[model samples]
Target: MPDLRLSRRRVLALSAVATLLPRSGLGQTSKVARIGLVQSTTGGSAALYGTEQKQAIELAFNEITKARTLGDIALQAFHADDGADRGQTVNIFQRLIRQDKVVAILGPTLSNSAFAADPLAQQAGIPVIASSNTAPNLTKIGDFIFRTSVPEDQVFPTVLAYGVRKHGVKRVALIYGIDDALTRSAHDVQKKAVDALGLESVGIETYQRGDVDFSAQLTKIKAQKPDAIILGALAEEGAAILRQARQLNLDPKTVFIGCNANISAKLFELAGPAADGILVGASWFAGYDTPRSKAFVEAYRKRYGTTPDIYAAQGYDAAYLIAEAIRRAGTATDSRAIRDKLAGITDFEGVLGRFGWSPERDATVTPKVLIGDGQAKVFAAAPAV
Candidate 1:
């Protein structure tokens, strides 16, 4: 990977200022700092994702506190459950930034919520490290906006290319939730890839996030008999669509391809056997073969009595990112220093393995495809490229 650290000239400038200033940047300053963790803990199906993310964040923070990850500076997390409502997200973000005076924020869970609340943080010039917003142009929102989630632009084309080659997919259809920003953005990426691959566009369908019935959409898709139905939705929403499609017998031969959105327990629990035979590409897998990843999985299972999914992994790594940035910046209260440190990160080994930032401040990360097996409530390696 190319080095994404700041240029030597910028580093020299910062160093010069550090020499003139008296103890404010890194190790010289020690103060308590507040961080906002905004996620949807209540609003319907979204809690499936937000809950895991929240749990993982807490877990990571607990470990960091025990380890004194920030040295003399103490970090306090202010958790808020936005209920997956855009209005509530904005309100929570405002409170966190203004009243609580947090230096940084972790999330609002969904990309829809991110789009809704990120601007507030940008306006205030606070750093926002999102854990699970995968839509395109998310980091482009501003310099303060960064995400650990791999965008759909990077994830879809590769997954689709593999699916088409391995499964002989000739015709494709897209079913997405139009109400949510993440799914809408994913729909755009999937459509572009379909056209690029020269696949026939069979049927396109849209739904809201909480809708339970997809019979109408499934019936229309069944008529086209596309080889694959690409889903651009969160776990619960996608599960409902898949279960409904199976009930309609939407061509048993037709398989499903999903983005990171479907790689969660919600899909396994809600869709049951229907989740099997689906292809999914995600930035993190619970069974990833890395020492750090294995330890994380083992610890999570022992604590929660259940395996953590991609969202949990993202949240866990995000917490580590926050603490590491504060340590590098040498001040928990300096948001700009934290932001620069995050952008300058050359390598960070976490549950996601080695990680860094792109020039645009998006995560410079690679994704792997995992196949769903109905019997195991978890994803396994795709077994092939």
Candidate 2:
């Protein structure tokens, strides 16, 4: 955990250098390629998740910058704490664009922040890639807005389908936070998937963003005795739901399925034994047996002193994808050119698996399922449709 803070003078100096460098100087001159990272550092139960995400981004940057081949394209990163505030996110993005003049933008992990900063990036003609923001509306932002992480529209359907098909789940209860865009999107997708499968959504419960108590929601859900309860919220709400469900002694034989946010180690820490049997669906797992994945996991652990989560893996993959796009475009100077190159990516052997992008779906990689108790195992692969 090296100190991630950059001094004001250093940021200013770097900003000045980035603005002054000519387009032709990229990858040939001494000027470093600056990347602006905006992530939430306050409020949400997922704040620690954001911190872990930042650590992963820095880890990838550190590894890439240290490589001899990347010497010409020094990867410098600037971080902004959006605190899950949309207004703060917009303000920070404007600052990064107007003041820092970053070549690309990396995050603002939540969908709300991604929604806010994405348009700003498009307006400024810079490419913005999100690691974890999964709201369905995010993909519609513009060509400038891209997400390495799978959108909820893609993730939730697969999760629900798996629960219904593979696990033989008949009835499901969904608990979601109304204020969170990702959760709402997941709920909608799950609802559709459940209906399509001819399974009953016996229970549906809602909560506010900052609400810690899910007793009422859990009480309602527990009474339904559905075959499974799908948690469609961030880490904090998910943890609360588990804790309250446990406290109520409402352990339905029904399996507990969770969205991507439930993959966080903090969720297990917060929920303790209650989180043991929880099922998580995600695009990448650090524990995957692939050589590239193993190496990435080992390097990330060596650098950060903890196991890397999917968010970290996604960040690393996003950086690598950006670098590859730069390589294909033959220069890092033109953001639009780099974006065009990225849009054409196919069969990219990334840590997350082979990445292929299309206008209809940005991610072509199949997602994996894992249990929260111990090492994750792939439950199923999403068939290429």
Candidate 3:
């Protein structure tokens, strides 16, 4: 019952509809809803993904506002960059909640940043929808915190299971970032999945977030000669590892299982042909053959002149989710009301497909798996996970 009206496609052209609507001020009674958008738009490893997220969010807001999706409530966005740093993220959260007086907030891109920053939003009664952070226990921060990005635990297992069935993977090695909440949680889930699937553990290696040389880890993993390697690192680190592994002359048949972060196009750019065999667990993929997902992909390509990835898809859905929550709450200014309505959303047709909240307030959607294209084009769909 959490407002399904906005999910349906609009019949009227947005330009045509805009002409009939009144302005926000100057004798017009329409209200402007201020929302804060936080992400690592620059000065961080997540900058590429963050930049795309910002672009998609702005695109979604443009479309929503043009269509008058929230009726009289026109959205006013206040975007901030946290540089993917925890310190900057917390300060931005405080500033958005207290100074800007935003009813809701989205992002603070990395999971470590979210862990450090979301508590402040929770204390301030501001609802936050995470477009990118997918570490475990994210929503456990409070009722006020939610995420359009599904948790690592929910999707990684399915990815591994699919790998086992299709690739006949048995012995698996693991590598992950120890310093990041996202990578750490991804590691934990991948390990758990490995154990549950009764796969042999040949080696487990760890690295810091910014390390470039994975030669030592790859050498050790190569000696073990596992059927597959599970990666808990993001695209940048994962790319480095893949290139180094290829240089080390690891087995050609060895498969690579990557987390949600490795779905970025930057991975292929950095790793070159070394990225050919990766299978990534993700919340969304560009070529998904569903109505909502296809529409989103086509719209995004039309607007941005580039195909949308998982990050862009996440941002677009997050914007609409917030807009829908605002509409259902009936008061754009009430943070608590909006939070409640957002948590109550049981069915939302998003680019990620039929989106909903898990009991943990994390996103619940059928996860998609992506594979390399044997060329520059990567991330084609594998079966749904």
Candidate 4:
């Protein structure tokens, strides 16, 4: 409950010159601006995430348009399904830039898809606000690339620290999908945290993205008898790993931890009783008591008949972020103006709390650590030392 509001210094200043510049030659002739939404709505790994992201983007865009926030300019959305294929993602991105003439794009859900697709958008001079790509090196792709979701570096260590201090976790086991760039990056981050905290890494294991059998990895993890197990896989895989580990006599006392991937209500339903003690790090949860957050949650539930997950929350923020940039630029058609506006974004608050872009083009935001019982509820902030 400490003062989490952004300070005045963090607010971006719009200079008189940038504000007064003439838009006559900046492709401002159009009365409507188009934003392309790229998501993998048909593929196995990303279908659920993509559906949620699309819904959230549409909700935010509708809200903005209904408020007439952009005056006479109409905001239109163009959606393309990536199908969870990197090649398809690249192709669709090119189409969005060349054919639809979208000023900005909201997603390509998977981090690997972003790695493949965002470069094309960057080279084409179109800004992309990645809704759910959390791997390292994403923002480092280029100045045009930005992500709304908190990265593993921002999420992991606190959860690890909590495990060590609150749950008495010392020795740890790590498991992740080696085939996935995002999961691999998460595993690397967890390893670094273990080294930094002087915690023993008892066992490290890897699995393929679609593989169901994890007996080999679980058996290895069981032999380690580590104090905690950290998983960098998505919800389905992570839940299965937890269940298999428990069945293999892995200690129930051993804490189970995951990153943003496990921040879904589906995990509890999927993993059943095995998911009782899991801890997940996240950016937004429906349990936030703020008026804005409560309203968003209520609206989302009314529309979708379910609680919004992190992917949905990030997608909503990304849409508003793009809309804010376009509004400041005075025209959505000017790529340079929009890019500049995006970089100067500061103190924009949303369902996720204070949102701003760091100089590196990464989102500068803190994460909340939530422990999943039947739901992922906020773990009370650790008392100050």
Candidate 5:
């Protein structure tokens, strides 16, 4: 069993529990564990991701509560909007722990905010199930922090190698959001993959997170005339880059490859024709035919009337994963016990295959290569073959 004791300072930070009511003929009242869901509902470029994540969390929680799988504890979830802002992320982290006394927190969407806000939860000795922060260093924040996303280091290389072999890609150009932590980290991983695979480096260009115009960067990339363009950014910027690449008359035959962020169906809608044939790496897609995947998709569609992408799938898995932690601990009242239980979980399969924690406390599952053709289609990469 993992350690369940918090530091002396952390134990001191915990608020005194109110006295329980004396047992009557009606029996002792059941305690409800409040789980705080912090997400980017209103602002930021990843708001769509946040919406899907929130819906999935709610859906999973409802299913678990209906099944009564968590024993005597009834569960309630409260949501807070971080708006994808770092300051707002910190504010909500404090509020969720102090006021709500939440057993755990779900997400704040982006890696940038996670880098800033996760430390607060770690200090409070609260376990956080990161729904979609894929940056490699996230779990290093503390023992209490965990994520459902496989790091870019584990995901990108295999996917990129497949794209290279399948599409006959030799020379590759790179574009990433310099300001965003996830994109910047992804760019580094892409570089390593390109080098390890012996692919030519044509050019590397970058933009700030909110920049719209990419003609200058695209033109520079166009000059290199690479066989593939690698995008290490979120959907909004990735879509914009594709649209701009098309407008600039960059070679139609040149393939566009993106990180996990490009797996969303909305990217297809945003970029329209430009999104077609774009390749991405993801741990979950709506098209997976497994029984668990099918059931999750059906429940999500019935509840929200929309097909969930990887973000939503991960968020749903995060809810159940935390609930399982509480169940395994035999008590939802103690945050330290829940953290220990989560750390002990291994080889649990959800919609994602073989879900478990790596030695660093991040997700250990590998992603499957997916191609966008109006929707994501499963593709086997050559390296995996």
Candidate 6:
């Protein structure tokens, strides 16, 4: 709820000329690195995730830039609120390129916006990394576009396979938002995983983005008596589905599993007891015990006064990856050099896991977790095999 805009002083301080010059007596010239963040904040429903996304980006940028003497490569963040409008995202991306002269771009959060903004950034030759957008087309946009989030094709199979192999799930009812590209992609992947595992997709239903009533969908799903319900949507819609399912007295004696996006504190708060036993695939959970994750969670809490979400961890990892690229490139101005360095990066320890980018594999395989009852457990890992 705080003012999301950058302050005038911060803006002036981050400008190209001011950042490139050495401090009055430090005798150390700094490289001013401008990064533009284009995201949605417009629709009533879209605003739900905007504040959290912005806060995560700010927290990561703050942690990465603190006490650093990257001379002249002083990082600066500029934000543009696209309000989930496709046209607005395109316009903002162009303005940042022409006016702000940002070297890189990060996020429009949703894949719909990314689908619109990424092509523009690619055409302009700016390296763009997404924090949460996971449309499969995003990876194909250009070599210049990268994403910290796992692709749905990769993530859903892991979740589904785990459910079928480990949890003995035989039948699942999938409920998703057809309008959102990311959710649709997740559902498609879920179907493929179900078929491959020989588990029945008993009932499949779709909803719009802002529909508060899911009685109709839940009613049909309840009749099928599925072994579990798989949610392929954001937290808000997932919460609504669970709440409706409970109200319909259709509580099956089956476990509920959802994609990574459903593993959030807000989902629990929104659905109350209905969210109690829902299991979700997650990239990073606050309860993780890894030293790197512990340090990040502690630092983030101290700075933001709250536990960070998976998106925050992704944002942190993205910034660290960019910083490492800069360090390897040895020059902040050479974008191509940075890109090449990023591609060649290997054995780079990260909060999520070790990342090694090869020309053959554009995606980074990170560890995943499961969350329930406000606690996170390491369920399984994608082994190097």
Give the lDDT of residue 275 in candidate 1: 88
What are the TM-scores, per candidate, against the unseen true structure?
A: 0.91, 0.88, 0.90, 0.89, 0.89, 0.86
lDDT of 1 by residue, 220-309 (tens): 888888999999888888888888888887788787999778888778988899888889888888889999999888888887888999
256-368: candidate 6 lDDT, tens digit per residue: 78876675557766777777567666666777678988888888788768777777777777777777777777776677777767667777677777676535334476546
Instruction: Give the TM-score comparing model 3 with the true structure, all chains together.
Output: 0.90
Residue 333, candidate 6: Cα error in Å is 2.9
- Per-model RMSD to reference: 9.6, 5.2, 7.5, 10.0, 7.2, 4.7
**In model 2, which regions exceed 4 Å deviation?**
1-29, 374-385
What tens-digit string does per-residue lDDT give for candidate 3 at 1-385? Answer: 7322211212211322233234542134357677877877675469868877877887888778767778777776777777777887787777678877889988978989999989998999999999888888888899899988878888889889999998899999999999988899999999999999999999999999679999988999999999999999988898899888889999889999999888776777788888997998787777788898888888888977888778989989998999999999888799999999999998999888886898888888877777876485668877543
Task: State how far residue 378 of model 4 sits from its true place (Å).
Answer: 9.2
Clashing pairs in 3: none
What are the runs in model 6 whose C-alpha is more than 4 Å off?
A: 1-29, 41-50, 358-363, 374-385
Report the error of model 1 at residue 192, Å. Answer: 0.4
In terms of lDDT, which candidate is stronger, 1 or 4? 1
For residues 1-385, write the lDDT of model 2, one tens digit per residue: 6323324434644553444333344556564666777766565665766777777776666556555345466556677677677777787788788887787888878887777678989888888878888777786888887777887667666667766666679988988888877788877877787788888889888888888888888888888888899888888788778877878988546778888777776776677777766776788876687888899989888876878778878878887777777667766567788778877888788888887875843677777766666223222333322
Question: Which residue window of length 10 is worst by lDDT in model 3?
Answer: 4-13
Task: Give the poorly placed runs of model 5, Cα more than 4 Å off.
Answer: 1-29, 375-385
lDDT of 1: 0.82
Per-residue alpha-carbon lDDT of model 4 for 252-297, expressed as tens digits? 7999988777776667667877887787777777777777778888
- Candidate 3 lDDT score at position 367: 78
Q: Rate the local accuracy (lDDT) of all candidates.
A: 0.82, 0.74, 0.82, 0.79, 0.81, 0.70
